[model samples]
Target: MKEKIIIIGAGVSGLVAAINLEKAGFNSVILDQSDRVGGRVKTDYREGYQFDHGFQVLLTQYPAAKKYLNYNLLDLVEFDPGSCIFYHQKKYYIGDPSRKLSLLFPTLLAKIGNVADKLKILKLSKALKKKSFDDIFLAPETTTLVYLKEKGFSDEVIKKFFKPFFTGIFLESELTTSSRKFEFVYKMFAEGSAAIPKKGIQAIPNQLAAQLKNTELEFNTSVEHIKANELVLTNGKTLAFDYCIIAAEAWPIIANLKNQESAWKSVENLYFKVKEKVIKKPLIGLIADEAALVNNIHYQPIKKSDNYLLSVSVIKQHNLSKDELINRVEEDLAIYCDIKVDSFVKYFKIKKALPVMHTVNYMMPPSETQLKDRIFLAGDQLSNGSLNAAMLNGESAARAVIAKIKNGFINVN
Candidate 1:
């Protein structure tokens, strides 16, 4: 008989774990507290508008993503190569000239940085391209801010370009995230495009969940506790399993097993329906002003119409009410785009947008994946805070379980 595995959380990690286990001829069940898949990568459709839980994009170059996801089926829509920065009451389009020749003059003429700074960007890109993933993560570890300073980036460029750009990606105002993460992300960006599915970001998870051939999924089923080789559900029922994997974020329920507390970064994504597109290009717009509450903006055009859905991200939490926040966002938008507060539609205040990862790694060892004898842990928190990490760790945990099963682990039956 096949081993009965119970995986907690129907997120990316859990789904990937189940997929791998099924390939190994083992059957597994997935339990998720939410009503649908895509734990943090969900999309809600309202009146023909797609609202992703947070402002998210998939770097096409992510190795795990490339291996697992079918991009052609996703029908991705790519963002332009670089960002359109709003700095000092002016808009400047800075792009990668290597990708598109038309962006050459604009990138060179943009005042966000000097010629030397642009040269440094190319230098950094070349340097990172040659370094493998192992080399990047295994090298010295330091704050991103320190790494940039040591690279000789001018204060003007760091403030106007890197600060707003990376702040939106890191979900933190300060560039205190690990330098390893910065280099990894930078290399990914240089290597590929940042894109979204033509349908929505959630489509990525939905695709993965659809591939479960030997797995059963129970939504809205919460696991209250785990004792020995059995799981106690919140409904006062218990189920036995040969192996269990906790794929959710670090929940208090499993706190004793992991013995680690996790800190998270937060963000608020405010969406608006507008009659016209703002910032014209499909590129991301960064607010270079240090005092600005709005971090970045993206105008996703609604299909089969002239209207657009504007996604505005604020990386910090504030005490203002909804009305007050919208008003302030409008004031900030007025500085660069022709937008009005009346266009507001919906907003999501995600308190845990991303996990705060200080020490970063590409992947974790099999020994570290096991929380106990039969209980395993899988999530981005175990490695780095990226979709790739979540997928990598999930597969890693599955391999560990497969190894144990091959070594003559008993069948519960």
Candidate 2:
């Protein structure tokens, strides 16, 4: 008989881990607290419109994703190569000239940065491209702001472009995220196209879950406590397994283990269905004016309907009712675009959207995936907070478990 393994949380990491373990001939059962599969990456539909829980995009060049997912199956919708910055009552375009030649003149004349600052971006890109994936993170680390300053990026570019663009990505306004993550993300954007699955971002997780032939997924089941190889669920059930993997976010892992504290950032997304497309092309509109509540607006088109989808990433969490927040978002968005945001609105907030990695944490060796020989941890928190990182860590944890059991260190009944 194959060894029994219990995987907690049906998020991307957990689903990927189960798929990998089952491929290795292990009996894996996945348990999740929610009915849905994707944790932070999810989508909801209402009255012929779809809204993703958060503003998310897949980098087509993610190494792990490219290896695991069948790109042709996803049927992705690609976003334009660059972004349109709406600042001070004008539109500025900054993008790769090789991808879109039409934006060449605007990109050159845009006031976001000086000619020298624009040249620095090329230098930085070339420098990062020369470093291997492993070496990028291992290089000297500091705050992203500091690193940009050291690279001689003008304050004009950092404020008008980098701050708005990266804050939306990192969900933090100060650019205090580790420079390592910044470098990696920049390289990804430079090399690949940003896209969304035709259905939604949740489709990525759904694809992984479908590969679990030997794994049983138990939904709406919460694990009350984990004691060694024993798991007690909230519904007065206990199961014995040879190994357990806590493949969840930092908050849930901390809740179960009852220790360890890490700083996290929160983000709020306001979803709306506008009557028509706000921008002519499918692109991201960034708010260069830092004081606004909306960080960036994503223009998503809908098929078989004239209405289009537009979601604004709120700059910070607000303490207001649904109606009140919507009103505030409208006021801010009007200043950026010339369109009316319609009624069908939904508010989504994630308290721990992304883990904030400091300079010290970036330099330290990653926490061990194996804990106490029986339990293992896997998630983006253990690695960088990206879908690729999460899936990579999940696969790593499974490989470690396989190695341990094969070495006769873990006994299976």
Q: For model 1, what is the C-alpha lDDT against the true structure?
A: 0.87
In candidate 1, how many Å is residue 237 off? 1.9
- lDDT string for model 2 (213-263, tens) is 878889999988777678888898999988888887544443455666777
Q: Candidate 1 — which pairs collide?
A: none
Please give the clash total of every predicted structure, in order. Answer: 0, 0
lDDT of residue 33 for candidate 1: 89
The 10-residue segment with the lowest total lDDT in model 1: 404-413
Model 1 residue 177 CA deviation in Å: 0.2
When summed lDDT is taken over every stretch of 10 residues in candidate 2, the lowest stretch is 359-368
TM per candidate? 0.96, 0.93
Q: Counting only residues 3 or more apart in sequence or on different chains, how many pairs clash (N, Cα, C under 3 Å) in candidate 1? A: 0
Per-model C-alpha lDDT, please?
0.87, 0.79
Task: List ranges where model 2 is wrong by over 4 Å.
Answer: 249-256, 359-367, 409-413
